[model samples]
Target: MGVLVWNELSRYVSLTASAYAVWASFWGMFFRKFFWDFVGGILRNPGGIQCVHISPISWAFVLMSRRPSPRARVFITVIVKVPFIQIMTTIVGFFILALEWPLRPVKGTRFHRSIPLRIFLLAFQAILALLFYQGTNASLWSLIAAVFYIRALTLGESIGPWKEQRGTVGQV
Candidate 1:
């Protein structure tokens, strides 16, 4: 039970982290000038600026522009450069992870074993990918983060359940 909980938690974290990375990339690009100005202002003089009239948009851009950890940045950079990572992430997240491995149907299950559902998932993933495939560094990084998130989900699912089952077998 502990392992299962941990597995689920890790999956949620991965998904969240990746989603954030993608969102940050998009946000940073869209508000490039504002983000930089905000960051520079914060760094140059942390408490010097009086609250004259700052817009919520400016505040959001500042918050979004904060630098990520070095390891995370490197990981995102490397993952984005790879070609197949995006496709794999989409497939894993939408098809395998989302459906909880319905291809190998478990006993006593009825509704989850539909081929059409899987097909729809695949189509949805493809469409999403197409929509986001603007040739930009930010988009690439977003893809990389998405892949990491989905891969984490896959790993958590594969390892966590197995460990739980093994523990139960041992007890029995």
Candidate 2:
């Protein structure tokens, strides 16, 4: 029974990791698009006032309203549209996704689990999305990515020890 549960848990973890990676990559693409567009716009018109309200939401609107440069378009296409790059990104992202799970809590203590490091990381990522992407969609997607990552981590923690124990028992 334990072995069966462990096998199911492993499958679940792999699926979850792949899904999280794909989702994160989607947000990453959004972030890249907005960031490149903002850079291209600023480079084209350095002194132009981008926003009237000067708030985060306003800035996002302003960025969304701008036209992307040809260079920016090509860059986005190469990174996001190219088939090979997409596959490689998904592969790399899976590992990146897997790594984030262990950072949330320590192995054996309740106090260590009190503070989730992923929340701080999420905040930092949100700030980057706000500053560079400056788009509502990008921010929202990043938030979703954070939520999915947290869920994946929580599920992994709940199931991981069972798998390890099952492995040891089989070895014995």
Candidate 3:
């Protein structure tokens, strides 16, 4: 029972964390005017950037922009309502739902039949996240995820910038 309870909690934390990531990606700013600057600004001052502890799912990832440094309750309150963040999470949620391909069920369904698998996948992801959140082995996994995320983000941006620099997609 203890394991099951922990599992469920971890799963919720995973879902919440995923939502937060999408939220940050979309609106860490632009909502209540979340201002953040690397060169040192009020929104994201020199020390504003720090790892925020997200309970049950420790060490998720919070940019910690501190233009004003509101209280915890207030900070969370604002975050959940941020326009960009909410929209981003909504879009992600919709995408995941759409992945189920509910529109055309018959005619030899493929991914539709795998809905259970999808849920399980989500749960498994939650478990992995839980490990990072509270396990003693958290640091290593977190570091790895961070590195991979950075590399992917950099590569993704590079593709577009490279294309622009070449003066068109294939004209380079």
- TM-scores, all candidates, are 0.25, 0.30, 0.24
How would you order the candidates by TM-score, starting with the best? 2, 1, 3
Write model 1 residue lDDT over 1-172, tens digit each, in one string.
3434433443444344334334443433333212222222322123332222345765532322344334433323323333233444344344434343324444224434433333344334433333223223333433444444454455543332222134554576
User: lDDT, candidate 1, residue 54?
Assistant: 45
Off by over 4 Å in 2: 1-99, 103-115, 134-138, 145-163, 168-172
Ranking by lDDT: 2, 1, 3
Off by over 4 Å in 1: 1-4, 33-172
lDDT value, residue 50 of candidate 1: 24
What C-alpha lDDT, on a 0 to 100 scale, does residue 35 get in candidate 3? Answer: 25
lDDT of 3 by residue, 102-121 (tens): 34433134543433443444
Each prediction's RMSD over C-alphas, in Å, is 14.9, 11.9, 19.2
Candidate 2 clash pair list: none
- What tens digits encode model 2's per-residue C-alpha lDDT throughout 108-157? 44422322444344434444434323233434544555565465566554
lDDT of each: 0.36, 0.43, 0.36
